[model samples]
Target: MLHIFCPHCGELRSEEEFHASGQAHIARPLDPAACSDEEWGTYMFYRDNPRGIHHELWDHVAGCRQYFNVTRNTVTYEILETYKIGEKPQVTADGKQTNAPSTVKGQGEKV
Candidate 1:
């Protein structure tokens, strides 16, 4: 069983207690009407399935019932860090750690 940390609850809990929602930091289209059908469809349907490091949205269903972001390694199934919805992650996809928050928008951002 995997242990997942819920940033809201600040506790390590069982994987069964949580649910993986999807990819993190998805930005909603500013104007749905303005977007082409393909654009809207892409926004609603497309998601990344990377082989290595990934940022995902997860929910603490059995505990806090809040959404959080998780930086994990897909190959090893190792969770690098758990962060709150709006907080920046310490680890990046390139395997670098930084003390400062990332300026790149839509990366691990909440929809």
Candidate 2:
């Protein structure tokens, strides 16, 4: 099982309380109408399922219903951080944080 932090509620909850949405920090096309069909297709279908240090978007569906981001090691299932939506996670260059997201990977724990 995985733990997810809810930035709003400031609690670490079971992964069951949250749901993984997909890769995070994606920028929308500047001009959707001007994009070629292939470009649109790729944006709609292409996803990078990296094995390590992946950034993902998740929703607190059963808890606060707020969207947030997570940095986790897919291979180890270790959560590096969690942050509220609309902000970049304050990840250090070495992949550490002075204040990690308020949620936990398997349970909500205060940092």
- Evaluated with TM-score, which candidate comes out highest? 1
For candidate 1, give the lDDT. Answer: 0.81
**lDDT score for residue 37 of model 1:** 93
Per-residue lDDT tens digits for candidate 2, residues 1-111, read 766667778887888888889988887899999999999998888888977777789899998898888877777787777877676665543466547444333323322
For candidate 2, which ten residues in a row score worst on lDDT?
A: 102-111
RMSD of each: 6.1, 4.4
TM-scores, all candidates, are 0.87, 0.80
lDDT of 2: 0.74
